[model samples]
Target: MLPPDARMLASQNIVIILCGNKKDLDADREVTFLEASRFAQENELMFLETSALTGENVEEAFVQCARKILNKIESGELDPERMGSGIQYGDAALRQLRSPRRAQPQGTQECGC
Candidate 1:
């Protein structure tokens, strides 16, 4: 069962992926692929078993998630302009974190304190 916070995030239509790490360690697995897959489906999450050591499915997971978010934005389901949407796009997003650098006066040099 998902915790309350996770459930709340899901309710907000957050793009969540449930990743099973250490996929290469089959003998040490506590949960089967079917079980994880089923749980993800029930919880409306994207699922993947990834082996970090092998670098397997790591990039694919991110790519798939980006695709899902892009599709949602394109379908009018996710509005990046909406406050608390958690989406930042274009130069506007960059501009938010950037401020104009003040120029020092001409011939002014700072001595190391």
Candidate 2:
């Protein structure tokens, strides 16, 4: 039973990464690599076992995530104008998309001009 927000986010076409951190202490791990990998495969998510202390696979995980995102961007699968789906926007691009019409003052019977 996923939360409402979780379901909503899942509905959006976005990348999901299942990263198991603290791989330095694998002996104490409850979730096995096979299980995590299989789960990721089933859910269409990227999986990476990372270790912050040893710095193993940390950079690679980031690079992999970035690559997936860039691929989506290049393919036009992720639209930046869709709004609020974790996409970064530029200020100039936003300004260009805004309505150019100016607002009229309220309660003015008619325009003097």
lDDT leader: 1
lDDT of every model, 2 decimals: 0.77, 0.72
Shift in Å, residue 84, candidate 2: 3.4
Clashing pairs in 2: none
Candidate 1, 111: how far from true, in Å?
52
TM-score for predicted model 1 compared with the true structure: 0.74
Instruction: For residues 1-113, write the lDDT of model 2, one tens digit per residue.
Output: 22346537644567778899999998899999999999888777799999999999999888888777666765667656666657755787654423433456897564222
> Model 1: per-residue lDDT, tens digit, 1-113?
66558646543667889999999999999999999999999878899999999999999899889878766776667777677677757776544322323466899874311
The C-alpha TM-scores of every prediction are 0.74, 0.67
RMSD of 1: 12.4
Model 1 residue pairs with clashes: none
